[model samples]
Target: MDAGQIVEPPRILARRSGDGWVLYMDGVEPSYVRRLDGAIERGRVLMEAGKVPGVEHGAVLKIDLGDELNQRVKTSTQATADAHKAQVAAAAELRRTAAALNEHGLTGRDIAHVLGVSPQRVSQLLNDQHARG
Candidate 1:
């Protein structure tokens, strides 16, 4: 086989050996085909050889598994972005609600009790313009 040239109908053949299985291709031993006693073994043999038995010229390139590192990085980035956005939104809502409660003659402690947050948090939200307000 020439380098960089893809083999077509890459042949894989399997045969039973002593208490196990042996896999081969073009009379070359590739690997040991294990646990072959039924249809599962047959499927494994066929898949490894890049061919579907009983089907003429049936071959397909193996599926490309995605890069684990790339997937993890993308997931991490999206999660961080979503968390930041949620934090900003929650802070803005807290400030708005605090202002409304203040208009109704509610103290920071009362607003905290109604909103289920700490009184210090309510004070921070009301006093600090940069605290998501």
Candidate 2:
């Protein structure tokens, strides 16, 4: 395959057959996804070899795996958002704790040692807390 050549994406037909999803591609046998791993593996091999043009890498030929895969994507996205929120909340809590410890006569170096952070970080947190107020 030429590196600069543009390959048109292939049209794929996906359907729920009985108990599993099946993907149909031109010039390729219909593959039973979630049933026979070989079909999925074969699709991957064909795409990698460029025998199947226009198929994106790592894509299951754009076959819709129905609700299960859709839900998984949603759940994964939510998890990522939750992780960010948790990190932000933890940073806010740390800043408040640093300020409280400083008010109790703990120096920036003492707070840094107890909090397992650099003295510079301790100073920054304290300054950030003051600015927020």
- Highest-scoring model, TM-score: 2
What's the true lDDT of residue 109 in model 2? 98
> Which segments of candidate 1 are over 4 A away from where they belong?
1-66, 129-133
User: For candidate 1, what is the total of clashing residue pairs?
Assistant: 0
Q: Candidate 2's residue-wise lDDT over 62-99, tens digit each?
A: 54657898789789989999999999999999999999
TM-score of 2: 0.52
Instruction: Please report the TM-score between candidate 1 and the true structure.
Output: 0.44
106 Cα displacement, candidate 2 (Å): 0.4
- Which pairs in model 1 have colliding backbones? none
Candidate 2 regions off by >4 Å?
A: 1-65
Backbone clash pairs in model 2 (N, Cα, C under 3 Å; residues 3+ apart or in different chains), count = 0
Candidate 1: deviation at residue 11, Å?
41
lDDT of 2: 0.78
| lDDT string, candidate 1, 1-133, tens digits | 4667654654444455666555554423445545534323444455655544332434322211246855886899899999999999987887888888987999889999999999998888788644544
